[model samples]
Target: MSETESRPAPSQLRRLPWSEDGKSAYLSTGDGASFLARMADTMEEGMLTTAEVDMTRALSVADEVSASRAELKMAVRFLAHAVADAVEVARLRGERLGVDPEAKETAEFLRRTLTR
Candidate 1:
């Protein structure tokens, strides 16, 4: 069977249990909060690394117009992914702190837009 056929559908995946108001009500315990903070730091570092790589690639290809164009395209793709990762980190932090639900929703919307 093809890879697509072998995998379960999106709907078949286990979903996280959200609060009744469609918000994450579970406040992170001490350990959970620490874990979330560490993850956020890791994600931020990764995004910074991606940005640095994109800049290096762009600079290296500056003399070649065609190559520069390709590098710019790749940079945009990497930046988009980085933005999404940042958003996820923000979402996790917000969930841990029990921030406003709308803020989380807005972050998720921006992440989806970047992915598309």
Candidate 2:
């Protein structure tokens, strides 16, 4: 819905964070060197890094037998959000690499295995 810096091409929409209005935002890095492109790249990287940290901490809290109910709830909530963000990030990256986003989602595979 919003352009980062310049007009994007016909295809190759880069998935960006949701807009303030709660709509999907996209960018076309015409040449992959636009100011917005760089910003988006940085933001995605930060998201992934932060998610990893949050997931790690959350998992630790979840595994603690002595953890309070409130502490466990907080951990599970953080983990759920981190996993959602990660799924989107992975899907976008997979598309950019010419891979089918649904080819074999790690999350889906995990769910299937866990269910069995």
Model 2 alpha-carbon drift over 4 Å, by segment: 1-10, 100-116
What local distance difference test score does each model get?
0.56, 0.78
TM-score list, all predictions? 0.39, 0.70
C-alpha root-mean-square deviation, each candidate? 12.3, 5.4
| Candidate 2 lDDT tens digits, 36-113 | 877877877888898999899999998999999999999998898899879877777765666554756765798899
lDDT of 1 by residue, 51-115 (tens): 66755655555645666566777766766665665555455444446657797789779989999
lDDT of 1 at 11: 35
